[model samples]
Target chain A: MIRRSVAVAAAKLTGGLSRRLGFGGGTALPGLVAERIDPEIVSDMAAQLGRGSVLVTGTNGKTTTARLLRGILRSSGLSPVANSAGSNMMRGIAAALAESATWTGDIRQRDRRIGVFEVDEATLPQAVSALRPRAIVFTNLFRDQLDRYGEVEYVGGIWRETIDGLDAKVTVILNADDPSLAALGRRAGLRTLFFGLEDESLAIEKLEHAADARWCSICGRELSYSAIYYGHLGHWRCEGCDTSRPGVEVGITSIETFPEALSLTVSLPNDQTAQFKLPLSGLYNAYNALAAAAAASALGATNHDIERGLRHASATFGRQERLTIEGRDVEVILAKNPAGLNEVLRTITNNGRSENIVFFLNDDIADGRDISWIWDVDFELLSGSLKNVTVSGIRAWDMALRLKYAGFDTFDRVELDTERALRKALTETPEGEPLIVVPTYTAMLDVREMLARWAGKKAFWQED
Target chain B: MAKKLRVAHLYPKLMNIYGDRGNILCLKRRCEERGLDFELDELSVGEKLKSDHYDLIFIGGAQDVDQRRVAGDLREVKGDALREAVENGVVVLAVCGGYQLMGRYYRTAEGAELPGVGLLDMWTIHPGEADKRFIGNIVVEWNGGTLVGFENHGGRTYLGDGARPLGKVVYGFGNNGEDAGEGAARAGVFGTYLHGSLLPKNPKFADHVIQAALSRRYEGIELDEIDDRVEEAAHAAAVQLAMGRSII
Candidate 1:
């Protein structure tokens, strides 16, 4: 009783001060609230809503899909409290809730009809238990952290178990391009809708190192791939079972890669193809957009609204988020895993320039603490023709070794001195070619801070 | 265009994780500098691996499943041909899982034991008795010289009495064993879990492996004088780590 009163007082104080300060929920507020009240207080707080919420979860494209859905919901006459700050954890969701709430812990009734949430896979079971979402959108499952997440199959098993007990009213959205995720729709019946790519141009002729989709999940037959987009996400089928990348209701009709942006033509369920241009590179974003459209369609959003909202949506922080660093247009790509890195490498090389490339590999605790994934990335793709490769970060030498083995020739071996490498890599950039810096999570933070120090206020400008 | 080296890359597509191809590129470029041949043959499963014609026999690391799939294929090649090639002399260097498989047997975490090539007189046990997280820099002294690389693996391997130890453990868990089982060198087969890419930065080790192969093939094979720049760079990198300074 005393703890409840204290938490209420704290919430009120924080809510009152948020108007003066820019932020509302501090890092420790969620723990404070959980200790004071029942852990289910937030769910109880959300129960007052007339329409249940939509939950989106995935390993790679969660933020992109969530942002797209958020915009679509807003355009369709609904306001959503999404964790737009890129915080996808429990505390982040709590912060989003606190932002949406009043001093008395009530969601503002007049704000909107629905709330779309992008959730981390590890936190999904807890979040689903707390906030019984009316619908759940699972993008795809890939090998993320073997140290944290045993494997993709383990995560897939957990998701199957989670969805089995849900009520008949629950709607499920899955990516058919993913073998593990597409398998979820098989047993789901009418509640599930699988969305994926149909374009042949995204297909990989041969399997790369991180090929996890070798066999069919259902029949255990050898899987055949007509086209591989990235990792195992592609057009695949089991010869024994009729399993394949299910025909998506919404799909990317065409994708034209520009020197700077990706032009996509998406065919919607309403018999109209909406041409959407994202200021980012890669088909992964196209998948993200398709997922958002599918999630929005479940919530009664129209095709026109989805298109407008997608145009309004932009790339999330550090996931191909671009910035101007000391007059050079730099793209901060988070290559945490092999799939993500392969996409980054493919996108950058599409421009066909042998230019200055800076790759930072920091195997910090938060960054999976396993640098073994670097071997899986096709460094061979970057080795032969690329000009002026600069390696930096804690595992800089390690990366250098990998690059050398991949058949790349470097002028010098730059150590983990990020500041020096950044300066040299940027300053010595060939007259016309661009300098692309691919960094891991922590390295991204460090590079951003370094850029902020270098360029002052301009470094911390609007990301979109 | 200049004739690219006729370098036969044994396992280009598979048997790699951690930039193992970097080692190939390093060797190819060094060969290219002197106008040597370069040709990469991607020997995948179901493909015959005739190591007779190749100047270099390069094999890389693979996951447990991949190792199992490739094991039978590797076993098909008469060990006598490889042994004769090494005896007659062919440069062979293996890394990580590849290094483990070259020995007698490899046991995975799931308690499944797989047969190794018996190339090296050793065996590897997966999910090493201790944590395999070998981050940062490490040093190993081999043949009165120091080689630098990073060590990261979960398998603890015990050396058989007949096998020769590659180097002493200067840092990290050398081979996840008590005495820091850094590497094993027997005949022409060189095995090490260390991936300093084992070449560009450490040229001496690269030359040594190549020399060991060349000396067997030719009665008086003369190694071209190697520039000391590669060893100088590796030494400088190691010294910085030893002094606790960033060399970047």
Candidate 2:
């Protein structure tokens, strides 16, 4: 107990020092320091949450779903401790827990606290063992950071192993529309609940090039989809073995995507329905909301609480996060992988109001050194719609080349420096029009920092 | 009327990992930009390859499991056709896993040998799970020009005496990393681990592929150079990045 107390104090001190030194978020460092001092820091702190933890994980929408779940938990009168800034590794969870704990390693109001963590796909196994969450929500998986995660199936393999090791009491909330997740839920013996989109209006005619998990897990044969709602996600069934998507407990009956928000009518498990307007757009967010609702409901949040929570839920950082810069609305959307980029493009163009857009493509380690995924994105979707396009970051020329190949003859500007590109993009935007900024993971962080500073707001890590 | 180039994309659905479809898109866009008709045919598992039908054949990389499935189909169904096409000097481009499958055989880390199509006289051996995979931005010297792309592979390939190296490694790991040889090339078939979609940034190499494919039907046709300033800039930037960052 003394050692644990010392570890907590050291971690808090390290976090404060790092924040003061502007070391960028101090999200993972304090946890690293704490773990070195006491290896049992995560399990120790997570045990204090009487309501237990709920882990949200997947390749995409983990942050947003976890944020929404946190909102739902809060609405249900439960105080949730979360790694809210999207630092989702084991150390990030440790940092969030360490920050919540007192110097003596005791969590104040322990019975009321619930750990709401968005864990990384690669770190899910470690997180599950350490946090021992009461519920786990999986958003749809897509090919993301291939250099780090290898392949999508590799992630699925790890997830299967993790789920197989989980206790039977732990609830598993899955996206039934995602064939891979649906298959996982079917195989996993734990208490599982599924959420899916039943609206055929949001379905695409064919699977996009970026779709992964096309093969049925049970039979190893190609699964046929009745409707593909973006990437390999929809009503699917295997012809080889007759395996198919499980019946969804929480399903989106209808989704109406607006210019700035999405109106959804979600059908709950017991024929009860919850209709709410989420202050976010796109079918991806709709999936996130469904995942959140199912997980929250499983964790004992009422239908009214779910509706109220979703209605008041705002955008997570760097994900459709809107900012006002000089009276122009600048929305920053993070587009790291092909599927995510495709969805972002679809959402932005669906409104048909976006004229000025900026793309920042970085090849940093965090952004996956291979920028080849950009080619998989259907940049041709923005062929004639954009009035001005600015390409920036380390691989700005690569993006420019991609846009050129996509049939864009000329770009408004190609700037390597992000700040300069952001300035140029904002300046070129006509008054009263919105400027959409799509950046990779690291690029999004840099852009968000610059935007936050410009908007006279705190840095992402410092905010809440 | 523009001349037509028929392209056969093998296992486009299964073997299309790591943005490899970008290579096909690059080829198609370049052909269209040159006022040539680009015709594409996608062939997947259980599908037989049509001999002498395609001017160019493209096979991208895939996951390990999918690669295993493709290897079986490639050997039983399309092996003879592919080998005959290679012998007939059909322009072929294979990246990463596709390149491995075109070799004589690939020995797994667990020592199980999987037979390949043997279109290229080479073999690959995955040096166990403990050893690091060759992954990152790679720069190579090919055809008296610089070729830049990203390579991520666990298997180390060794070229037999019958095969020739595609390029010399300038930066990053290539082939077995010890040999500094990157990829294998013989006749019109080019097999490499470079998957920055290989052709989009390296427009000259893409043109070489187009030229080789067109020569079979058009005979000594010279491809008109389109504006490649953006491509060249991207290539230069990648080369610079590869040099700046030491990726083993």
Candidate 3:
């Protein structure tokens, strides 16, 4: 106990020093240093939380879902510790857990504290054991970080094993629209709550190019889809087998998406319905809201509490976050994978105005070294009358090539430097027109810091 | 009207991983840009492959499950037709998983031997199961010009003595990590793991295939050169990226 206390104090000191030196977030460094002293520090620390933990994970929307859940939980008068910096590894979770702890290893707000975290898909099993979550939320999974995570089916395999090994008492929250995820509800004697979008009006006319899960997992035959929302999320049924879209306990039946916010009518499991005008934009956000509400409900949050909490939901930093700069509306949407980028493009195209945009692509370790996935995105949809596009970041040329092939004339607008690229894009945009800035994971961080500095907003780590 | 080129995109529904449909799209666009009648046929699993139907054939990469399924479909179903097409001197370009399937066999990391179509005298072996994929931007010296594309593959392909490589590796691990050879090329048949839509960055290579396919049906026909500035710029940028230089 004495050694663990000393280790925690040292970790906290490292984080403080790094932040003071402007090392950027310093969220993982403290936890990494602490783990060197005591490897089991996360499980040990999580043991102290009385309300236990609720884990949110998927290929995308984990960060957004966790943020919404955190807000909803807080509104219900429960204090929860969350990692809102978009960090999900063991180290980041530890940092967030340690921040709410004292130098003497005593957790702050012991009676009401809960751990609400977004975990990486590959690290879900390890995190589930360490956090010991009472409720696990499975958001929709798509083909993401292919070079890093291989195939989505591989991750699903891991998830099945992890789910099988979990405690029977732990509740499972799943997306019924996703066939692989919805199938998890059939696991023997496990408690599962399913959530999905039920409105066929929001269905896309045709499936995107990079969509996956076309074949039935059970029979390996073609799965017929009545409507595909995005990347295999929709009303689907396998003709060969009886498997199909399950009945959702919590569902979003209708959604009105706008440039500023989304209005949704959600059906909860208790046979009650709630209407919320969530301040977040896009159909994807509506799904996140439903997932958050379901997860919060599993933790005993009332329908009133969930609706009240969701009504106040906002973008989780760099996630469809809009800022007005000198009368120009610039929305920063994080695009890390084909599915995520397609959603952002759909949201932008929803306005039907030829969008002036900037795309930042990086090939750093965190961003997936293989940048070939850029081609997987169907960018031809943005060709209606795109005003202009500036491609930037470390792999700026690759992005520019991809856009050019996607039928966008970005040959004369490639900028390798992200800062200069933003300036150029901003300068070229007409007054009052929304300039969309689509960036990968690391690029989003850089763009966020740049925007935050100009607006005097707190850094991500500082805010969380 | 120009000469028609029948193009068969094999297993588009199942084997088009890593955005390889972009390659087919590029082929169609280039053919039409040059005033050629391009007919693209998508052959999925359980579909019969007509040996004489296509002038040029393209096969893309796939994931492990799809690859195994495709290998069986190739062996038990379309193997003879594909072999006949190859022997008939049809211009064919296969990438990554397609390249592996055209070989004698692919020995998986789990020690299972999946049969291949045996068009190329080669075999592939996976080095390890985790984090061993050869993935990155690659530059190759092929067809007397530079070709730049992205490669991500778990198996290392070894060419037998009778086969010839498509190019020498200017960068990245190609074929086997030690051979420094990229792919296998014989006559009008070509195979490589490079699929940044392989041909968009190398219009010359794309044209070479178009010309080869056209020549198979017609005599003394040369494709007119359209302005390749945009394609060349993108190509140069990729080449620069491969050579460890920024294309700002």
Candidate 4:
């Protein structure tokens, strides 16, 4: 008991000190310190959660999905303890758990509490063993950091192995459109619930050039797709085998995407159809909503709860944050990989019009040192109308060069500093034009801070 | 009259992990800007290559599994044609995985042996400490021009005595983290880990390849100049960033 108390106290001290020193939320460090003091601190706290845990993981959309699920849990009368800041690795999850637990290592909420964590794809196996989650949501996988996570096949293989070992009681919620996750769900041989886009017109004509998962996961044959919503995700079948998109229990049928809002006509389980208007933008966020709704429903969340949560869920930081600087519209969008970036570009260029773009690319540990992925993004989509683009962050010039080769004519100052670049981009933005700020993970944080300071808003970490 | 440039894109699907398609786009766009009609023939797995059909050929890099999958197919179908193209002075630019496969062989991080085209007398091995992956912005000086790109590789390539290096590394880790070299060049073949997809950031280098191929294909055909103000600025900014003169 004394050892556990001491560990909690140490975590609190370091976390408090970290915040007081203005070094940011020190959320991960405290947990790192506590884990060093008590090896099983996370597992200990996790064991006491009567409702168990829900683990959400993938190459993208983990944070937003977790946030959306948290709202559903709240509406379902369960207090969800979640890692909202996206420090998804073990240390980050531990920090969140330790902060929410009592000094004696007991969760304050006890039976009313449910743990929700967005584990990193590479670290999913470790987290699964530690949390022993009651339900796991398998979001679609895309090619992410090659240096850090190898490739899509490697990460998918690990997820498969981990899911194979999970007990039958552990419910698996997955995206039916994703071939990789669909194959895993099939292999699980359990009553897995699936969520996917049911709107046929929403399908893209052709897959992006950098699309991964072209080969069927079950057989070595190439996959034939009726529609590629984005990347290798959407309505695909293996010609060499009977592998294909599974039957979806929770599906999105009619999607009306707007600049600030999205309305999805969802077909729920038990012959229930509900209309939901989400405050989030982009088809990617719609997919996240479907995943969250399906997971929440699998965990016994009612349709009313799912609808309310979907309606109330707002954009998580850096996903599609909107700020007005002096009456000029500025949107902060995060793009970590080629697929995500292409989606962002497509979303921003929905009307086939170019918005003033500020690109923040960094090689910090979080941003993945290889800026080569920029070449994979379809910048040509915006080349015809893109007139003003300001490149910033560590690899600002790299992005500028990519835009240039994509045949974009205008190249603003390539500012190494994100703050200065943000100002230039906003100032240069034409009157009544929205400036889309696209940043990688670390650069997004920096740009968010600068924008928050400029607009007199609280930084994301400081938000309650 | 401007002559048409026929380019072969080797392994568009299997070996395009690092945005090698961008390299193809760069070549095509440059050719278009210079008033030359650019035709691209995309060859995938099991596709055969004919030497005389293309004036320029581009092969990209891939992940370990993809590299292994494509290497054998490359040897079976396109190996002899690739050798013939290089010998005929056709401009061939290979990056990262493409560069490694142009060598005699590549030993993967898992210690698997994958044979290369052996067009250049070089070999690559994943370092003893795999954690020492040479990644980040890199600057290399070659033929009086400074080239900048991002390199993420655990394989440390060493050139044999017969092979000449593309350039001396000005900043960041080069061919092997120890050697000051960055890429290998032999005859008309150029292999580098420079994948800001190489051509877009370095228009001059892109032009160098175009001119080399054009010079060999058509005599006394002058390439027209296109406006490159934006391209030049992008290149300068990349150089400044890579040289550490501009702190990000």
Winner by DockQ? 2
**RMSD (Å) of each candidate, 1 decimal:** 5.3, 1.7, 2.2, 2.8
Q: What docking grade does candidate 4 earn?
A: medium
Each model's lDDT comes to 0.69, 0.88, 0.84, 0.82
List, residue by residue over A367-462, the lDDT tens digit for candidate 4.
886677888888888866676788888777677777777766445567877678888888888878888888899898878878877877877766
| lDDT for each residue of candidate 1 in A98-157, tens digit (9 for 90 to 100) | 556555666676446576778878888877887889899998776665545534555676
User: Which segments of model 3 are wrong by more than 4 Å?
Assistant: A315-320, B127-131, B245-248
Docking class of 1: incorrect
lDDT of model 3 at position A413:
88
Question: Could you give the candidate ranking by DockQ, starting with the highest?
Answer: 2, 4, 3, 1
Candidate 4: give the clashing pairs. none
**What lDDT is obtained when candidate 1 is compared to the true structure?**
0.69
Which is superior by TM-score, 2 or 4? 2
Question: All candidates' TM-scores?
Answer: 0.79, 0.98, 0.96, 0.93
Q: How well is each residue in B128-238 modelled by candidate 1, as lDDT tens digits?
A: 434444444567777787777655566777789879778887665676657876888877778887764566567778767655654553445445664545345545655
Q: How many residue pairs clash in each candidate?
A: 21, 0, 1, 0
- Choose the strongest candidate by lDDT: 2
What's the true lDDT of residue A321 in model 3?
67
Residues A1-464 of candidate 3: C-alpha lDDT, one tens digit per residue: 87678768878998899989988887888888888887888898999998999999998889889999998988888898887787788988888777778997779777799999999999999999888899999998788777777666689889999999989899999998888897777789889998988999999876677678788888888888898888778899999987898898899888887766788999987689989787766778888889999999889999999988887555342333667776677788888888878887887787654479998988777888777777778888798867789999887877776787777767688888888999899888898898888888889989988876665666666664
